[model samples]
Target: MGRAPSDSAGGDRLRFLRSFLASPRKVGAVLPTSRRTVDNTLDLAPLEEARWVVELGAGTGVYTRGILERVGSDARVVAFEVDAQLSSILASQLRDPRLSVVSDSAVNVARHLDGAAVDVIVSAVPFTSLPVPERKQILRAARDALGREGIMLVLQYSPLIERELRQTFTYVRRRLSPLNVPPAFLFACQGDPRSPAGER
Candidate 1:
């Protein structure tokens, strides 16, 4: 396969704009995560003991690949791809036995694994244009899945969603990834305060 285009996420978003506009509501599948950005997010992970990695809107396995590269070989990754075509592609391409590609709604993150607490929930969903209710629900589910000591990392193109996370999580962090399309922001927050791993 040819190398994916690597253009500055600034004004020339290239593949990001094309992929993001592929669907209605001005939103599409997840934007491909850049390697540098992925490593940065992985560095933000609090617990070394985490076994479950839940990926929301894995899209084409961009961040999924990034997470896999950082986590242990036995770490379980539950990838939720809301797009059928993308899900099918991910299921076949990822060779790791630890990867489970689920073709389902991202809002059902908790239900898919029987309400189990995940160590980390990395979301690549675009929330700026979504209905407020749907946005709130997704954030709530992400918070719930953490159980205790669980964290949710959201990669967004705008600051609007960061406001939502601030109200819900114990503490919220905003990191700029200069490597991605549009130089996205990485919002990391603890779902619940009491269970924070004390790593902030």
Candidate 2:
């Protein structure tokens, strides 16, 4: 119905998995993301100059699929999935050489980025579950890694992050997509976030 999810989806590895009952941990897998979240997240930003886009928590390659479609062929997408199963799915799906799937925590965003400044960051992580400091870390990483004119697109289900986002960014714009499963909000922010000319 909605464009069949995305075009650049890596392969047929991602079969529609039904919710399975097991350990508490396994049961949590039932929280699989909706295609609407992915759609809303990627649709928020224009992908023209997204030379290097970092996708945090690229679960099951949903967001990854959308990102690959947006950027140019020469552009690179560095995606991170902290879960083992999701990481494997991401690796299999994004078999193309364009994507680099880091099977680790998104908080290690700085290390994972390898000193490269990203033109944009599209995130699908549920920031509502995290503590304020953790969210701040992620936001700081986004702002710190962005080029002067760069931006960060965070599609969170909570509007509460607005208070925190205002602390770091000069400008913050929010859009709502009620079509999503949980109704997501796209937050875009930008600023002259930079370190001193020669600080080490």
Candidate 3:
């Protein structure tokens, strides 16, 4: 049998569940991404050489830890979690100098980056669940914020947005993770994306 959940982890799980209950559409998942999900999604990025990393919908900082482990101490990580309560928990839990937990929408990523050279973008945000406009905005922001060699890693339960990704990104590759709770599709996109007008 597995050990019982620790007090802190149990509390965190409760909070996560509460957030999902409060906003099912926004929260997207009842549980955070599993370790395998995080690893499979981030493997496509060159974390070792990455100087700056950005995370979208960093619900509970699962992928944040993975990025930190792979990168050097000098690297910077900026994570965006729209839910204030979840962001608070993430800030308190991950007290690393290299990490910044921002309580804002993923679309505001560029402003938070403030002209930094971003090397990798890992997104746990449920794009398919979001409003179409919001999804487009976040995708555009990711494309604009990336450095010349930057790569955006998107984890989704479905491949429904592959068309959108292909239009916004110059190249897109996907892989599936059957081990995850709901399973997942990991998209690795690189190069400067075309404008929305060009998408048509």
lDDT of each: 0.73, 0.69, 0.85
Model 1 segments more than 4 A misplaced = 1-19, 24-31, 46-48, 193-200
**Best by the TM-score measure:** 3
In model 2, which regions exceed 4 Å deviation?
1-37, 192-200
Worst 10 residues of 1 by lDDT: 1-10
Better of 1 and 3 by TM-score: 3
For model 1, what is the error of residue 56's alpha carbon versus the real structure, in angstroms, after optimal superposition? Answer: 0.5
Residue 95 C-alpha lDDT in model 1: 64
Model 3 clash pairs? none
Per-residue alpha-carbon lDDT of candidate 1 for residues 1-200, written as tens digits (9 for 90 to 100) = 22223334442234444556677453443346677777777678853456898988777676777777667767788999776766776787676777899998778887888767788989877777777888788888878788566788888777788778887787898898887766878888884644545332
TM-score, per-candidate, Cα-based = 0.82, 0.79, 0.91
Q: What is the lDDT ranking, best to worst?
A: 3, 1, 2
- Order the numbered candidates by TM-score, best leading: 3, 1, 2
Q: Which scores better on TM-score, 2 or 3?
A: 3
Error of 1 at 8 (Å): 19
lDDT score at residue 65, model 1, on the 0-100 scale: 73
Could you tell me the TM-score of candidate 3?
0.91
